[model samples]
Target: MTAADFAGTKTALALASSDVTMREAFVETVTAAMDTDPRIAVVTADISAGNFAEARSRHPERVVNVGIREQAMIGVAGGMALTGLRPVAHSYAPFLIERPFEQIKLDLGHQDVGAVLVSIGASYDDPVWGRTHQAPGDVALIDTLPGWTIHVPGHQDEVRALLSTALAGDDRVYLRLSTRRNSRAHSVEGFTAVRTGSKGVVVAVGPMLDSVLAATSTVDVTVLYAATVRPFDHAGLRAAVGSNANVVLVEPYLRGTSAHKVATALADVPHRLLALGVGREEEVRAYGTAEQHDVVHGLDTAGLHHSITHFLG
Candidate 1:
């Protein structure tokens, strides 16, 4: 795919109705699936459980609320998985992945169980809630464990599709949802090409696609959109890089989260990679909107443009 392929489509799609959020879509998709699929179960830690009222009413035994206990939530989900149930756990990013990481590593990874772990409040989605709500290292931490599928959907449509795909299989999957979204959802198989250029390739993960497109609008570089980051698409990236091999990875999570994967992907090919994302050097204690945080972390359009142009040069 190239810029010409999506010319004028994104702007038009952005104007269309977008009242449905990723969380709502998750609830709807999982609830409808529960009506027919008895193996599917939803486990929540007092977050987003109200949205599943109808589903819980119908299948009380399956839809469980473990209250504010995130660790126990994972434990319960793991228990359910042991009993042949497909558990889908939900909570904020920090509470879901960061808080109960030991449980995840032990209860799921150690036990060799499969569950669909869903999270909201991506990074600093609700900045007013402060660092406790922010989890820029979620994906990076999950990477430490083995056999986990990570899906960071850029739009509600993508969310529905990816969630369905995860629910269909009994794999240890992590679906990262965010309030930020792209204007449109691309048919992402693996690092889907949105624009082709010769100077280099700019890999945009999840919600970073739109900003990436804006940043490299005039640059001669290929832009790749990755809704699924884990099991990094080595083949697609290798093909995109061709010979130039100058790559810029623009992720919404911690900086260099996918740098190792990119390095491994292009290990044989000599390449220069510039990893851009939330900074870990220092924590910003100020309360601001997510966009402000983006600017602070050099993830805004301007920040991305500056970094891309400098790296390309």
Candidate 2:
């Protein structure tokens, strides 16, 4: 347990109660940074009060509320960033990325302006909000850009780590912070192997960590929680799975984004291969909520367990 290369000011963050949220952890970190650096700004695409109450209370003026217009809010945040202000643009995942694809890609990413994009209640909590709101393909779509750094906190701790790193770095970062209770992970300070085994490698992204652990234990396999997706932990995974003939990737994103990318990376390599992800081709219609969909799509406990077991055996 050596010190992280850059843990920010909250080294004691992991020592907290169980009710913490990655969204909260991330906000707290940003709030702290803002306390020191007046140039740090927080922007909201209409839902600032609900998603970032803590942040707004502290920096009321810093929170540039645009009242539901996500695209315009992002443009403002980008403008702020280019003007030497570190801005965090907060909004719902679906609207933030999908609704403003052109703005984010062109105005923010292509401009090379670094703004931290935080999407709250990210993947599947809105069972009642229906498909349009429940699952946002933010991580999958944004990560496609060349330099965007993607962060999906499995738990509060990992959220803190990634947020801390993103705050200190100059790269554009997108975090899909889950708004669901069950979607929280315990948090690992740095992106390190949660566990490793010899049979094969299981790379779990986001809150699918439990499924990964279950599959590995059931099959006596090795697994890695890729807390960060953009960079893809290429070196760490390669070292861990070095000469193995089997590797599996599990993610909450649509198949095209997460697992598929991993499978393609190892496409030419020698190994048994499998990728488990939500199918993007299907029209999203709020079948039941993200959790229910995970179960249906086999991203949940039963599904992940099944996918890993069948793949390994």
Candidate 3:
């Protein structure tokens, strides 16, 4: 199977509209969940609170707005979790994960509580806001802690499905939402094989799938799509690699965020891995659009094609 193989599939046409973003889908899915599931509560740091006006009106106690204090937002979610409420924390990526990281590490992780941390402004999604609003290292930072189910949905439909699953469980989950999306959503049961070839294996994380597909369209390599990244699909990846252990991981977060997992998964098998994503070598001083930043980080289609081809060679 290859990129062409996905053409006209039912899943591809289900929600192919580019208008429905992952964040919007999250708000819709979560807000609806609040109606049925009394345990589903939301904690926000003044981000997207207006979008939840109806939910807040219906369930005042469940919907909390912690002003601009990101720390307090996490603290509130932790408190709610302690009281057996499934808290969903929302904010920009930097504020949600980076700003009050200590509170997350201690208030939630140390307290052994569970909450759904939903974030928008993925990496440099709003690069015009500058680096302060960006958080490419969010996933990498959260990886340091244990017992987190990190979800990076590539499409709005996937977001709805992943968020629904997270809400159904009492576990720590980081649902990273973004403006970036693919043309369609995959069923996403672990690392799904989108394309198969004998040259090498490329694992596309979340929104990176479209770019990865285009980059490897001509190359004789297998492409795997991963929406649920944390519980890094070790078995799926190992199976994909089979004998040809040349692997390339294309993540939307910080470069090499899941490189260690890949390394560990293929520990016994001889493999050459190329980890591509937002580069950490230098700070992107210039403020520009997210697409421009993608070029800077070599995450754009051309950049990905160049790097992937070089690695496959």
Candidate 3 structure quality by residue, lDDT tens digits, 47-146: 8999899899999989999899999999999999999999999999999999999999999999999999999999988988888899999999999999
The true-versus-predicted C-alpha distance at residue 23 of model 1, in Å, is 1.0
| Model 3, position 289: C-alpha lDDT score | 88
TM-scores for candidates 1 onward, in order = 0.95, 0.86, 0.94
**What is the Å distance of residue 185 in model 1 from its true position?**
0.7
Cα-based lDDT at residue 19, candidate 1:
72
> What is candidate 2's local distance difference test score?
0.73
1 or 2, which is superior by TM-score?
1
lDDT of each: 0.94, 0.73, 0.92
Off by over 4 Å in 2: 1-16, 50-58, 180-191, 259-268, 284-289
Q: If candidate 2 were superposed on the true structure by all CA atoms, what would the RMSD be?
A: 5.1
